[model samples]
Target: MRQPREKIFITCAVTGNLTKPEQTPYLPITPQQIADASLEAADAGAAIVHIHVRDPHTGNPSMELDYYRDAVEQIRGKNRDLILNLTTGPGGRFVPSHDNPRIAGPGTTLIAPERRVEHIAALKPDICTLDLNTMNSGGEVVINTPQNIRRMAKIIRESGVKPEIELFDSGDIALMHALLDDGTLQGPVLCSLVTGVRYGFQPSPETVIYARNLLPPNTEFTAIGVGRASFTMVAHSYLAGGHVRVGLEDAVYLSRGQLAKSNAAMVEKAKRIVEDLGGQIATPLETRDIIGLPQPAR
Candidate 1:
C-alpha cells in the first residue's frame, strides 16, 4: 500500500517546449522572465522550479547554452536555495516527412545526443530531466532509444547533476529499472510520472497507483498532471507517496475559462490543495535533505 506523504515538495515547471506563446499572454519567454517567474514561484511555496528556455524573439523552445546560462545565473543570483531542474527533453522530437517517413520533417529537432546535453554540461543545475518515453506525441514521435538515452545519461552523470527520469508510461519505468541494473542510473532514483498527456499515461487514481507500485524501493517520484487534470493530481500525488508539479508547462488555466496570470498563481493554488489535504509543503532546503541532494557550494 502506498502511504501518504506528510511533507511534500511542489515543482513549478515555469516554461515548457510544447506550450506555445499564443496559449497565454503570461507565459515567461526571455531569460529574465523565466528567472523572475521562478523566483515568484519559490516565494509562492514551490521548493523547486523546472525550466525550459525559449527564444526571446521567436518564443520557440531553445537549447542554446547562453540562453540556459542567462536564465540559470539570474535565478541563482536571487535565490540560492531554490532547486533548479533544467530540461534536456528537446533535440529528441522526430516529425517524420509524409513523402519519406525516414526523412526529418519541419518540426523535427533530432540531433546528436551529446548536443542535447551540451547545455547540461555547460550549466550543471541541481537537477535535469532525462526523458525515457518514445511514444507518439501528437503529429510527431518522440525517439529515446536505450542507446541514445545511455549516451545522454553519461553526460548528465558526468556533469554531477541528478537526472529526474520522466516516465510517461509503465514501460518507461521498466527501462528505468534496466538502467539502474546496468549502473547507467543509480538506485533510490528520482523520477516524475507524467500523466494526462494524450497517448501517454491517462490521468486517474488507478493509473497513479499502478505506476507508483512499479517503481523501485525508496525511489522518489512525482505524479504530474498535465492539462486540466493538473491540480487534481496534486492531491492524488501527495496521497500516493509522491510529490506534485504544476505550472504553465502543464496547464494554463487556473479554472475553466480562466487563464492563470503567472506561474506563481499556479503554485499558490497547488500549495493550497496540498495543505487542505493535511500535507505540509517542504522548503527548498528541506527538499534537498528529503531527496538527498547536497547544497551547492557558494
Candidate 2:
C-alpha cells in the first residue's frame, strides 16, 4: 500500500449547489462569479477546486449542462494547473411524500445515472464526486442506490475522470469495499468522508479518524465536516494521514459567528491551519500526481 505524503492538499469547494445569496452573500451564482471564485481560491493556496453551479436568476442549484460548460471553460481558460472537481450530487435528492408512500413528492430530484454524469463526459473535469449511500439527509432521502452507484462509477471510469467516493457513515465502508472488489471502482480510491449532515455521521474528530481508518490500504481521503465541524474535521483528517477540504460548500463561517466573505478566505484559513501544523501545502501538480492523474500537456 502506498503511504500518505507529508504535503497537505486543500480542496476549496467553491459555491456549492444549495446556498443562496441571502444565506451568504459570498455564494457565487453566475458563471463568471463561480469562475472568478475558483481562480481566487486557487490563488489562495487551494490545490483543487470543487464546483457546483447555480441558476443566475433564481440562485437555485442547477444541473444545466451549459452552466457547467461555461464555468469550467472560464476556470480552465485562466488556470491550467489546478485540479477541478465538479459535483454529481445534484440529481440524487429525494423527498418522499408523507401523504402517499408511492408518490415521489416535491423536491424529488432523482435522475438516471447517465443523465447525472452527462456534464462529466462533456467537460471532463479532473475529478467528480460520487455520493455512496441512500440516506436521510436534511430531512430528505439522498437516494444513491448501489445499482445507481455502480452505473455512475462505470460512467466516471469510462470518461477517465476520477471519482471521489463520498462516505457519510461507517456502514458505507462495506459498500466501498464491494465497489472496489467488483471493479465498479478502480484501486487507490479517492474518498471524501463527510460528517455533520442532518442524519449522517456525527461531526466529531473521533468519527473522522474512525472513517479514515476504515478505508482500504493506499486509499486517498478528504475529510469534510459540514457546517460548524468543517475546520475541526479538516485538522483531524490531516493529522490522521488524509487530506482536507474547506469552502462555502461545507461552511459559511470563517469562525464562530463570522461569515466568510469569500471562498479565498476559507482557503487562506485552511492554508494557515495546515502550515501551522508543520506541513507544506501541496501544489496543483503534486495533487494530480498524488491522485495518479496525468499532468496536462505543457
Candidate 3:
C-alpha cells in the first residue's frame, strides 16, 4: 500500500498592514472584523492566522498594544484552538524627504529594536514575524540592520514565541542562518518566502525553488505571493514541499476582476486547489505541534 501524503499547514494572513480599503473593499480593519475573518479562515481549514492590526478609526497600520490585545482576545474567545501569529514587522519604515533628506519625513516610523516586538512579547502569540534583512521596500526603505535583528531575535527567543523569519529576497536566507548560528533563533526555524512585492523577490517557480534550496536543513517554510502572484505561488509552494499562506493580506481578488469577500473565501479556494493536487489540509492542533507553539490553555 502507498503511504499517505503529508498534511500541509494552511496559514491565513487576515489583514495586511498598509494596503488600504481603496485598493480592495474586502480588507478587514476593525477588531471585530479581524476576529470574524480569522474565525472564518480557521473554519475553512487554515491552521494559523497571521495578523496585523489596523487603526480602528482610520484603517491605517497600528502597533498599539490595545489593538493587538483586543484583536487577540476576540479571536481567542471564538476559536480557542486557532494559532495566532502576530506581526512585528512594523516600526521600521523610512521614507526620507525628497528635497531635504537630512530631516526624516512623515513616512518614517523607525522605532527602537526592543519596541518593534513589544506587542508579541506581551501578547505571547504562538508566532511573530522576525523580518531579518533591511531592504528598499517598494518606495520606502525598510531598515532592519544586523544589530537590530539580533536584538529583536533575542527578545523573541526569550519570549518563547516562535519567530517566523520573513525572507523577501534570496540574501535573507543567509541572514536567517546567521541568526540561528548566533543562538538568537532556535531549532526548526520557520520561514516565509514573500514574493511579488514592489521591491522584494518576484514571484516565480524558479525563484521559489532557488530560495528554498538555500534554507538550512530541517527547516519548515511557507510561501506567500502578493497581488497577482498569489494563487500561482500557492500552487508552486505546495508542489515544492512547502506550506502556503493566502488571504486579503496577500491578495484581495479571487480573479483579475473579482473581489474576495473574506479571508475564508480565499482559504476555501486554496483548499480546493490543494485537494485537487492530492494534498491534505492541516488542523490548528497539528499546526501548533509542527511549529512548536504553546498549547491553548485549559
Candidate 4:
C-alpha cells in the first residue's frame, strides 16, 4: 500500500529579535511595514507568520506590549487568514559588562518568566515560541532555565496558544521532555530546530537527523538555518520529512551575495525548492489544524 505524502508547513519569520536596520536595510520596523511583509509572505505560500516586534522609532528589538498589539492588529486587518506566532524569546538576553564581569551591561534584557509571556497571554496569539535552552546567543548569553520554560509554558497553554518549542541545541530536547512530563506542554508537539546561531547547533544534515531523533514520538518539527545556510538547511529539512522556515529574519540574502528585497521573495524561493523536491506546501487552514489554532475570528 502507498502512503500519501506529508504536506510542508511554511513559516515566515517576518522579523527577528537581533537584526537591526544597520545590518540590513530591508528589516521591517514599524507596525505597517511588518504587517505588509507578513501579508506578502502569506500570499506567497507561507502558512504561518512567525513575528517579532521592533521599536517603531529605533528599529531595535522590543518586548513592548503595544508594539506587539499594533503589529498583530495590523497584520490581521490585512490578512485575516494568516496565522500569527508571536515570539516570547526576547527579554532573556544577558550580556556582561566588558570592564567588569559582575556588572550587567545595557544589552541584558532578562525578565521574570511570567512577565516574558505576558504579551502572549494578553493578546492570545494562535502560537508563541518557548525557547527551550540557555545558550551563548552570539556574544551574549540567552538564559532559558528549566523553571523559566515550565512557567512560561503553563501560561501559554492556559491562554489556548500552542507553544512552538524552539531548540537551539540538541541538549534542549531533554528540557522539552521535562516540560511534557510536567504537563506544561501538550502534544502532538511542534518544534523548531534553530541552527547557525553563535554557540548553538550548526546547520548540517547530520545535525538535523540527530535533532529529529531527539524529538518526542510523532512530533511535528521544522528547521531554520541562519545566514548562508538558510537555503541549504531548508533543502535538508524537506528531504528529511521535516518542515522549513525562512525570511529576512533568518537570512537577508537570496543567494551568496544578493540581498532579498522582501519576505515574499524568500517564500517564493522556498516554494520553488519544495516543489522541485516533490513536496506540497500546506495551506493556512492545514497549518492551523496541524498546530491546533482556531480559525481567525476576523
List TM-scores for all candidates, in order. Answer: 0.99, 0.97, 0.96, 0.95
Q: For candidate 1, write residues 1-298 as lDDT tens digits.
A: 9788879999999999988989999999999999999999999999999999999999999998899999999999989999999999999999989999989989999999999999899988999999999999998899999999999999999999999999999999999999999999997799999999999999999999999999999988999999999999998999999999999999999999999999999999999998998999999999999888997678
Q: Model 2 over residues 1-298: C-alpha lDDT tens digits?
A: 2233489789999888766678888898999999999999999999999999988899889999999999999989989999999999989988889999678889999899899999999999999999887888777888889998988888888999999988988888889999889889888989898888887888776786678778898888988888888888877778878899999988899999999999999999998887888778999999998999999878
**lDDT of each structure?**
0.94, 0.88, 0.87, 0.87
Q: Which candidate is the best by TM-score?
A: 1
- How far residue 65's Cα lies from its native spot in candidate 3, in Å, is 0.6
Candidate 3 Cα RMSD after full superposition onto the native fold (Å): 2.2
Candidate 2 vs candidate 4, lDDT winner: 2
Q: How does model 3 score by TM-score? A: 0.96
Clashes of each: 0, 0, 0, 0
Full candidate order by TM-score, most accurate first: 1, 2, 3, 4
What lDDT would candidate 3 get against the real structure? 0.87
* Model 1: colliding residue pairs: none
lDDT of 3 by residue, 1-298 (tens): 1122388888999998877889888899998899899999999999999999999899999888998899999998888899999999998888899898876788898999999988978989888998976888867889898899989888887888888999999778887777778787787879999999877889998888888888887778887899989989888888888889998988889888999888999999998888889999989988888777767888
Better of 1 and 3 by lDDT: 1
